[model samples]
Target: MSNRWCAVVRCFVVGPIGNKFAPLGDPGRQSYEDSLQVFEEVIQAACQQVGIDPVRADQIAVAGEITEQVFRHLFEDDVVIADVSGGNPNVMYELGLRHATGKLTIQIGEFGQLPFDVNTVRTIQFSRSPRGLIDARNQLERALQAGLLDGQDVLTATRIFQESGEGKAEIDLPLPEPSIEVDGSDDEPGFLDNMIEIENQLALMTDNADGVASSIEVIGAVTESVGAELERAAQSGASNSARLALISKYASEISEPVEMLEKSSADFASNMTSINDGVLSVLGVIQNGDPSELPEGWDGFLDQLIGMAESSREGMEGLNTFGTAAEGLGSLSRQLRGPGRKINNSVGNMRKAIAKIDAWERAARSIKHKAANNPVG
Candidate 1:
């Protein structure tokens, strides 16, 4: 029986720290601290998952020569995790060495720092958020369970290529699309992880269905209340000035709720409009055709974007209806609108808004086309 056992692990925690001597910089020091914290959390989770001590390969480097110790760990460790957060040259070189070795190697980095070469390979995206860190750790744990416990000896191409006189052959066999395997309950979150969170949020919108109903009821109640007050004012034979006072008094009653709706509508519009920024990012990544596993599954991430886009469309629709309602409520008329509000006032921002929406549509279509043309394994 193969019993789970603790294992010696190595980390590229100090990337590009130096050539002969590890040079120290405040920026590098801060990066090391942050990246190391992330690495520590991930390794700890792996340890707990597979029953390993999660020993750092560089633990002894402090007592002796760092270069000799690091090079040894790079070649010998069963599993190695590299942090390429800043695209440090030393880390990149060491990562290349591990890549050549074809060992059970894992790579991680902060999202924005990865260069094209490194970014193309599968990597776990790191974030500093408490929840983000936890999610990253959970992802690492799942990956550890998948890669380590599977008990398979997959041959790495680099090992084979090095054996032949041909330095690096252009093989005819179609390269299998690289995928990240992970462990979790079947009900596990989608590739993005937050994908499940989005679904949960959409479900919460069902509760807001009740809110929408209550809003309607509130609208009716306010209407009836205002009508009654106006009726009383008319029956009392109040003058125009007095009647204006009466209506204004009732207007104050709905002011808060009206403001709340306005704020919500603005929020919805802003979020709806801003989603394009993320979509454009996806488009950029897809265009680059990086082989790495995305933080979100392409399909799932695209679907979530589609879902949010649809939700935002619906939200905009609702806001339009809300604006109409506000207009009808003569005394209680104040509402929020998107760039369309200023359509007549000026054409410039509205033109920009239309252009942005058009850009989003074009970008989305481009992504769909690219995904269709180049399906990943």
Candidate 2:
């Protein structure tokens, strides 16, 4: 009831309207249209309660490009109430644009009909029943009051990524060179080629490992913030829909880092395979050749090779913990299609690579044993 909360001069409403936007003859056209009508009624009442005028794109009656006008409202409005029911593509796109502004955004949707991307963002949910409309209106009014009164903007995806340092700092790790240089002796053409390739591939894998490690930190920070928000929402004694909205919003917020983790893990897994193959090839050459006929610095090369293998194996093990975290988060929503599947696959790949490295490590030690025993030969 404070004038401070009612100080908003502009309000924009966006959502799917009746069959106007729905395809003709669609079986659910009537239902979609009806939901929009109810949503409009409730939104209007809520805005009126908060002493603000609400404008929807269809009501502008402008002669110019409606698309441009819509974008302008989405960006410039003091308050935006977006009904994301039906998961319409255009509605979702507009919602995303609004979220980028980090302004006051009120998301509402029909229960059980929200998209995976935003299903957890704090939302006012409603049905088409008379009682549902009243409840939705009351919820929206309180939301508008709290949002405008506190003067705090919604924590959006853009803000989350910015805070997570997604673009500010490069996640690349320094490429490591072999500690000892090998002379280009004519006796070891193929062996040198294989060893050099392994070194290059190992460098790339090291970068991936660094990326994965950094992403884990980001994920942890984001999750901690989300947990706090969840607790606050729960304490508010809000509806399930409201709590889910909070969860969904943070879930979306964490998505960027989760995606980074997936990609890094995947790249690391791929490079591990290539490096393993090269190591095996080099080992075969060493095993078949006379230890006395080996190239200069062959002993040093073996040491570096085993060292790289051990390092790679350890890095992969560390990354598996991140994979586990991703899987756990995905299970909560069961709809995080990308992060869940890809991270799990990367974990599987890393496990395989770990086994391969173990085998390669053993083989390398065997060759060293042979060289030690045949030192005088």
Candidate 3:
């Protein structure tokens, strides 16, 4: 069997730094720390599941003053395990940033502390019990492995958005409909109108689906380009392992948004398939000159189409968020990967590069916003 490299794991604890456990009294503080100790144990369990040495892995605390350092280290590590048990604003902000970067990130929270915004994202929740911690650890480890390996494509795609300076593009949008004219040759009233209506509806649905597919394809392309840039950075020896770690940190940050978009796209496609089938059934009935066969809820079909279009727009918004995070991550990664001494020399160039990316992101957002707000028939 091939030897497995020890995964670099970072733990971001969202709470007040040392000695100020005021929210939780002395007894509660002790209990909280004890819970944290259990959290560490769970992480150890997860490491074992992936055939990695827990002792060999590095674990750093994410204190308030060292947020930037945390970002730098995040890139250096192989995986990140964030503890979101306390209601910590900084932690949540950092977590959102990480998601935007599209890195291998796993979220763990105490049973009741998870933020409402992130409740939709998959997370491992543990109780104060030993068994609960163990179970959470195993689940988180599996998620990490799957995210890192199986999600390589997604990770790479987000990286592209970063490198290309395109901020997250919106995914929810109503597709344009094609207009159809009724031919005078038909011997039926409303038959031609029905045909035109069906065709227009079908055209709109196809266009919407195609738009999502195109966005996904663009994301994939950008990811490939970033990968190439990373290889070049590695070969030039412009950046040491420490700097590389920084790049990895940014990557992890943006990876989450990209992954979310991928999921949204899959869901949209599945829903579209069902919608298409229903539309076809309606069309068949209309063609057979049986307008009465059109179900009473045919109007609902338009609503369904509108819903799909809206979903597509949401997916695009997710992509835009991913893109913004990617830009930050990519710039930081390149800087970290650049030669240590030359870092100062490249500062101006880096700013210009980042500015260009910002412009692209703005353009993408504008287009997505217009599309998303368009009236759906």
Worst ten in a row by lDDT for model 1: 342-351
The residue ranges of model 1 lying beyond 4 angstroms of the native Cα positions read 1-3, 7-25, 55-58, 61-63, 151-160, 165-377
Error of 2 at 171 (Å): 39
Cα lDDT tens digits, model 1, 70-188, are 66456545676776777878788877766655567777777787777776577888677777778877777676667675722534444564566332322121122322123335774
Rank by lDDT, descending? 2, 1, 3
lDDT of 2 by residue, 207-231 (tens): 8877876776786787789889888
User: Worst 10-residue stretch by lDDT in candidate 2?
Assistant: 167-176
Q: In model 2, where do residues sit more than 4 Å from their true spots?
A: 1-189, 235-239, 334-337, 370-377
Q: Which candidate is the best by TM-score?
A: 2
For each candidate, the alpha-carbon lDDT, in order, equals 0.51, 0.69, 0.48
Question: Against the hidden reference, what TM-scores do the models get?
Answer: 0.37, 0.44, 0.36
Error of 3 at 36 (Å): 2.2
Predicted structure with the largest lDDT when compared to the true one = 2
